[model samples]
Target: MYGGGYVFCEPDVHGQPDDPERLAEFEARIDRGEKIEPQDWMPYEYRRQLIRLIEQHAHSEIMGALPEGAWITRAPGFKRKLALIAKVQDEVGHAQLLYSAAETLGKSRADMVNDLLSGKSKYSNVFNYPAKTWADVTVIGFLIDAAAIVNQVANSKGSYGPYCRALERICYEESFHLKQGYDAFVALATGTKRQREMLQDAINRWYRPIIHFFGPPDNESVHSKQLMRWKVKMASNDEMRNQFLDAYVPKVLELGLTFPDPELRKDPQTGRWHYGDPDWAEFYRVINGDGPCNAERLSARRLAEENGRWIRQAIMNPQQKFTIPFA
Candidate 1:
């Protein structure tokens, strides 16, 4: 058992088991609370599935900084600026943790980073959008962080020991992120008329992206069954999305911010919030590299990499370093 209530299980190896009875015994052992260590035998598919999910998660954390990183210098006050800086730093730390987790699955971090930078991998769709204003940063902290909390909370019980432990640490940090944004939203809501207006506009812009962050519904989508059956994901995308709506919509209304959905309302009988569906086409477009700031974000990342390439080379190969004359 981990973190008091959840269990991490060893994945049953497929086909390599000696017999059907052995496979059943292995699965039965998993049904218990045993933890899956790195050296333990696991199905090839299980390793591949986890690599896919955790690598995407790491990439998301790294690229996720771009949207809010743009607003760091523009924060309204020194305190807010510092907070955003720390928050973005924490996101970078999350990337390190997740990438390390993925490394335990028999791949190198350098390879994963190369795949992400070269566009051979996908990150979260939410990061592709633009953070247009200072208010947009607050909204991102609140909504995006909140959605991640739901997913991370579910992942805290993951079968992989390292991933689950990393998620536990990440969840604690994310809670603080959520609270900081909540405080910011409350301050703006009670501030002058202009502040309120800006906050509302930010809410309008980020709501759809946050909703889409959960990805498409969990019907017959690709990778759904494999991920779910292998316990890589503990909750369905739509289920987690609904859980986010359940927690956040009322808080948004309490702050006098509209959710940008006219048909949104709570069902008296079932206690579930219902709203008009989001535009999946826009979600596809954004994930397909067509969002408002996709080009700018990628260019910034690429330029940073290129400008720092020499330093990386120097570190890896100190004897081959260039000798420059005094400036």
Candidate 2:
């Protein structure tokens, strides 16, 4: 036994064991930090659930690019343009990481891409909204990225080895994104009054989606319990949302900017940040493909996929003349 758990002893029963005690021992082994390899016993639901969760996350990452990627050409300055390009590139990299994680559950990255294109899968609701101005870019970087980081930081400790490892890299990139956003907000808040007003409007526009990004609050959320039990999700929707608010609200105020929420404040005693409830109706509308910019985002995604078809085919089915020797 190890750590109050069981271990297979001498005369290992690879073929002989059909006993209930052996099953108990196997479960105990898992509980004791033992690795469950490809051949290990597992319930069917575990695999299916992980595939669903990872595929959804992968779809989100890929689609997440569209909102911010739209701004790469319109960024205000040379530096901001380069930074936006770099940020979009990071999002592409994140999609790759997430797809690799999903592939471990017997799915292909191409298949997941197809799912997203065909509208058979869903993504983060935040991306469905419009990036209306340069200020929208800053808000996306600050509030949207901040909301994503809360969920991703929790995922860095996931039980699935591939996902946990991928999240470590994603979190590192997200940290940079968060800083870039904060810097943008600072620049805007400290600029002319017009800049400050733009920043505030952007904050108001994104605030609700950022709050709802964690999903519905406890009793209303169906999948939260199972997701937590499997360690696929570490924090409840409301818990993660609150954590994001606590980290950013003070910084927003320090710059003499105001978020739209009148009920928002920090409790000096409990040290918790409080805010009014998000508009769940709008959240549903966004999730159901009815957001203000949903059609445009999806149309752009479809066009990109369509335009790249020849390129993909050319790479996958290389002509004899294009073949190079590996030597």
Candidate 3:
């Protein structure tokens, strides 16, 4: 499950627009609830934005697997280990599904890999943080996975057929992921005092990143207007974040867990949650590759890529090199 909701991009451009007639038809189709297929003509920016959104989603699934995968061997019991292994496997499969979806936009999987490695593309910032304990794994799997569901379920209705379809499948598996995570979490919270403390400590550490999961609010982010209008973004960052808080905060509170932020509460007047600042500066810094475990995570990914390169070379055309078509 992925959590970083902000799609970091350069400032919006008002360059030459797409052919008015074609663009009108494209948007009208979206308005009429028509799904845009791979062969359908689309505006250049539509393709670019979809590629960016889907490619980063694909990368997040892959990178998000690493944290919990690391805990498989260290899980409490054989049953837990088996479950963790299966969950991690599902995540990797989700990545493959997403990459295939993104490939429909004319970016090869190879090109996507290069972009991720070169930092031209990014995964969710939440994955860069270390999972320090078994409790941390449950929080990542339960709360973080829950956050991803909120994001993906909203986007599952987006205009792009392939991405929406991929998210459909991913969301199904993710529900199971969330269930197992909640099971583990409840087990910890209801167990011995030490177990409770461990879970509580994890909750405290994760609360900030949890808020950052949905990125900046509507006013602070520059990504909304066009993409939202096109159905590329089904919900605003604040909308998704509020949805998550409304759904999950009560569950944690019922378990007697506490968020570190005293300012986190519902505004009775507006029915919206108000929260302390999650340090947007820190979120930006982490997304830019300065987080606690960013280097180590990428290093692990690079090692896998480097080691697997020969096998990849063996299976492919000797001289086939992929590049981003639009760029």
Using lDDT, give the best candidate's number.
Answer: 3
Per-candidate TM-scores read 0.88, 0.85, 0.94
Compared with the true structure, what per-residue lDDT tens digits does model 3 show for residues 1-327? 773475745534875568999999999999999999988899888888888889899899888988898899899999889889999999989888888888989989988989888777889989888899999999998999999999999989999999889889998988889999999999999999999999999999899888988887786444567787789988888899999999999999998888999999999899899999889999989988899988888888898899998997789885766653331
Candidates arranged by TM-score, highest first: 3, 1, 2
lDDT of 2: 0.72
Instruction: Using TM-score as the measure, name the better of candidate 2 and candidate 3.
Output: 3
- Scored against the true structure, residue 126 in model 3 reaches a CA lDDT of 90
Residue 238 displacement (Å), model 3: 0.5
Q: Kindly report which residue stretches of model 1 are placed more than 4 angstroms away from their true locations once superposed.
A: 1-26, 220-226, 317-327
How many clashing pairs does model 2 include? 0
* lDDT, each prediction: 0.76, 0.72, 0.88
List pairs with backbone clashes in candidate 3. none
- Which predicted model would earn the best TM-score? 3
Q: Which segments of model 2 are wrong by more than 4 Å? A: 1-40, 220-223, 267-271, 318-327
